[model samples]
Target chain A: MTNTIANIDKEEDYFLNLGPQHPSTHGVLRLLVNLRGEVVKDLKPYCGYIHRGIEKMCERNTYPQIIHLTDRLDYLSAHQNNEAVCLLVEKALGVEVSDRVKYIRTIMSELSRIASHLLWWSAFGMDLGALTTFFYGLRDREHILDIFEETTGGRLLQSYNCPGGVMYDIHPNFQKRVKECLVHLKKKLPEYDKLLTGNVIFKNRAIGVGLLSKEDAISFGVTGPSGRGSGFSCDIRKLEPYSAYDKVQFDEIIRTECDSMARYKNRIDEFYQSMSIIEQLIDNIPDGDYQTKMKPIIKLPEGQYYQRVESSRGEFGVFVESRGEKNPYRIKFRSPNLANLSALDHMVRGQKIADLIAIMGSLDLVIPDIDR
Target chain B: MTNEELKQRIAQLCADAVCTDTQDYVLAEIPANSLFAVAKQLQEQPDTQFDYLYSLTGVDYNPELGVVYHLESTTLHHKITLVAKTADRENARLDSVCELWKTAELQEREVYDLLGITFNNHPDMRRLLLDEEWHGHPLRKDYSNPQLIVDLIK
Candidate 1:
């Protein structure tokens, strides 16, 4: 047999357009990649296919009205975005939120973080070829969604977060139900570990797939678990404490491997960390007013305010420019997915085409988050 | 050092670069040419090791354009912001910070794409998110949003 399989004609370098439609690309993301046999030579990410110009649209809406819009940016972590925007607006307005409200917000945010990570781990597993993990992960996520639906009246886009505080007081059964979910989650995590974490196939596909050195990770602006996976200092619920995060006690997990598997394990450890935070906050939720009294029509001073919070993906930032109006003059979102996706070319430069999907899954690019 | 002492130090170091001073943070007005030297000095200072860049943003000051860098020291836990104001909107050039912080490369691309601010000596200051054929900077205040009306075929 010849070194190269002889075709009828000449062998041309094959180029395949992955998708603005494939499941692994997340939402409406297209990648034009050139392949040398099974190895990818070059990759160009084509985004903004779902661009709605949410920034421009926010300028046209009231500050309160725009929280609904932010929910759609990172649909999985809608609560976190809502909280971040609300925190900025509240800071601008100089309204002090009550302790009870703070605890509630903190609990909800941690729960949302767990849900988002579960979805990510599931998808990451599926991309590595463990299809059953995807279904199992979402099945757990569905329980969290039910809790969100019961409290916020929406599963994906919970406009539940307002400027002063949460939309309403938690229902009587909310705490009980959330506690039960936490218990269930704690019990379910070990099964997840057995099925996916311990599986050799999953480990081999992810172990050293996309390695980001610590310095390079920081330089490239990678954050959250991805950064922690590279041995960067712990950031979440620790540095820049928001809500009741300061009140909770939990260890920030870190791994120096800086590989795809490290990120996977970082997220799994964070799942347990989040559960610990949620359990502590939910049990000791103080009985008090859920929201502080503020003016109906809120206006911010003409200046610039920057707020940063640790979202499920990474450090999510909101830079709001106010012109002393009810609406923002200009609001810019520093999306984590954008930065994570930007590093794709660096990560996938020498990997095989199959590993490309796995790397993309590990980065967890929700296209709306990147394109918005 | 406190903000006052830090201000005094910066004022002495680059007398003309001190734009505004506050108790918590200092805002320095840096020229395009002197930006790199000033940034290097800031990193070298023993007390002030602004090794971490918190955020880099662009501001559309209409006729006068500007780019701002919010810098912080992880060890010191102090923060400072530097604003590089440009006189000519047509040119709107500033020194690149990729040397100080590698994160600035993509950030500079974002500022260039959204605010139409150019960075001198930037490695690749290409359009980041939007298409290259896109007509104007969408973030500019003057960019208009046109309303489209649909005609029913049925």
Candidate 2:
């Protein structure tokens, strides 16, 4: 894994731009790939195509308004991203949400993790030329979204988490539907191991396609399943638990193989973990208020605060500096996609160009998260 | 180790470094001139061994511009926040920590592109998000554009 990635005789290499519009990229991410025939001599990712100035927008908006902006950063982990801001505000003002809020937030976060991983699995299969996995993955993901729509009233961009706690109480059937979705996915996901994960073609394309050593994963600041694949314990949920994470007992998946397949397996195993978390907490959502009373206009005393949540992709951090005003003085979101994308050049330098797609797919990049 | 012990160890490493206890992390305001040396010690030292740079961001404090680096040890799991400032706003420069954390390669470039903070020894300090012909660092407080402005007064 510590193989030399020095200049590979660029005199004979040619350049190819993979995206800015390629479907395999997942968004308008362009990769400047230097290829010697089919083998990659070097790889450089060009991002920021979808930069919407969300950080700058946060400086102008009130604390509550910033939660909506964060939902756009990583739509897949919308609930968790919103939670990061809510947690930061709660910590700054010393506001304690009810036990009900804690359990509900944890449950929603896990549900979204499953939804996100399912979508990533679908796209990953498509990257390896197995389009059937796309349909199978999305079928399960839509059920999660259906549950989201029933509770949060938004399928994708859910601004459900507010300053104190969740914006609204869980729907009456939230538990029933979520349990059903979990049961269905729990039964369906293993079939994927046989159909896609066990397929010789898929295995051949992915097993050792890309290598991100534990050192490189840490040095590059890759988190979540991607970092876990390389055996780097960068899980914020485990290290610094917030909400009900400290209460739940779940295994942080880590694979020392440090390849594309390891990353794939990490996410698959995570699906089981996320479902188990929900199963443990769903039946016991403490009966209480959904949110703590917050002012219409929120203000924090001058200070700096940072909070991170384990989004489906990785660590979604909100770093805000307050000036005792409604709007924050400065805000910076430490997006996981950018940090994860940093590992690409090192991962695919010696592999073929086709492996680049497989590797990128395994990283499960949400480009909007990167561009933001 | 707790932050208090980490600060004591860092003080021994860099006698002149200003170590302040923040709510979140231990802040070590290293001198801009000795940033690289201090950073190297923080990375390679047995106790500190800050092998992971999770977040690197540039802050524009009007007349003063500073780089905020968040380092964590994968081995020990202790975290520290290192901040270095240069009052030279016209052509702000600091020694790059890209060699320490590979994640800084893209992140530092992003800071340079948006806030106009130059890294002295960065391998490739090109504009990452913006085109070659784009003008002004948009994230800076002084960089004005009517289209991009969100006026609080209005």
Candidate 3:
């Protein structure tokens, strides 16, 4: 062998920028990856590419006006984001919303959850090279969006939830359309399993990859399916039971596998759980006023109030510090995506560059939520 | 534990700690100096294992800068809020709890970026959501950038 061949440094490492604009990242997140050949030695995620300073804007806007701004963060889980703010205002003002409002809000939230997960499932499949799953996922998601449109008058960012309750009562055909969607979702879910869950290629790429321990999951504040994948039962829906979650019967999906496959399976199972919750509450919506009357000029007493709701991603928290004014002194959104994104570096280290895509897909990060 | 008991437990851990009952959880105000030690006890102590740091927020409270931490114990199913304030807004500093909870690592960086409050022991304490060369913290009450932020009369 030539001396030149022996003299080459095998341990040399190089840096690779995955995104500021890349498809696999799902958003405008930039990952600075340190690589030794194909293996990822370390990864640093650069966020705020889409940061609109939503928190600072919230301080300037009135509480009611701030609801729509939340829609822009995690647009997939827009309904849940609206609800978090509404719930905080309601709690602070001591407004007792009617049961009808509760049922409608709960149903809408679950519909949003299913829609969000469907998009994630489609995108995740595409990330792993299963293209057909995208069509199936989006096609099913349209049913829920139609239901939202008919009632809330907006498809994606409904902003249906006001402080006292929902924007208005559900539409005349709301129950019928929701039932039809549930029936369709139930039939199509098994097809999802057949297409990707059992595929040998997906199994090979997903299983035993990007492992996160239960302790690390908790320490890193990784909630939602990502935390549940590590057998960390941190489901805020089960823990606090806001809105009508306490009234509904649904299991919090937890997996002990602690890998990419586990997180994938957790979200898949959540699809059925979300449907069951809608089924339970759809027919039984109480007949009452949708919204409670409020003073035209709303002002919260001088204090800080925190409210958390289980969004599709994880625990989405809203902390409002009000100084007895219509405009909050300070508003901070404890976005689930930000907490979930923090764990990416920890999970992707030592994994191959290809597996990094699979892990990121499993995390289901909506970058606007992180940057906001 | 009840909020009262939780408040008392935290009081026992740090004598100067001021614990109050919020509508949802116990809110404890720990001095800037004792924040790290009190946080360590809350996590390591068997009775109050607040292992989950769900939310960490930086607030510019006029003359004082504060950080609010929401902690929950998965095993105990209890929650508490801790607030630590630094009066020196000009050069605000607090001990980083990223060592105790890994989630605080990025969150502390965010606090540093948005509010100009620095965490002493953060490993990678850099601007998170903004460019490194960005002029001033936007979230501070006093922060004003005429080009960036348009002031609307309330």
Highest lDDT model number: 3
lDDT of 3 by residue, A1-372 (tens): 677786685567999999989999998999999999999999998988998999989898998999999999999999999999999999998999999998889889999999999999999999999899999999999998998999999999999999898887888999999898888888999999999999999999999999999999999999998999999998889988888999988999999999999999999999989988988998899899999998888899988899999999999999988899999999999888888888889998999999999999999999999999
- Clashes within 3 Å, all models in order: 1, 0, 0
Error of 1 at A231 (Å): 0.6
Q: Relative to the unseen true structure, what is the C-alpha lDDT of residue A217 in candidate 1, on a scale of 0 to 100?
A: 71
Tens-place lDDT per residue, model 1, B1-154, is 6677767766766767756753225777777667788887887799888776657877766666777787777668777878777877666788888878777877788788777888888888887767787766777776653423443332
Sort candidate 2 into its docking category.
Answer: medium
Give chain A TM for each model in order.
Answer: 0.95, 0.96, 0.97
TM-score of chain A of 3: 0.97
- RMSD values, in order shown: 3.3, 4.8, 2.4
lDDT string for model 1 (A179-242, tens) is 8888888899999999988889878888988888887776667788888898877484677898
Rank candidates by lDDT, best first: 3, 2, 1
Model 2 ranges off by over 4 Å:
A1-11, B146-154
Compare candidates 1 and 3 on DockQ and give the better one: 3
- What is the alpha-carbon RMSD of candidate 1 to the true structure? 3.3
lDDT (C-alpha, whole model) for all candidates: 0.82, 0.88, 0.92
Model 3 lDDT per residue over B71-127, tens place: 999889889999999999889999999999999988999999999999998999999
Cα deviation of A212 in candidate 2 (Å)? 1.3
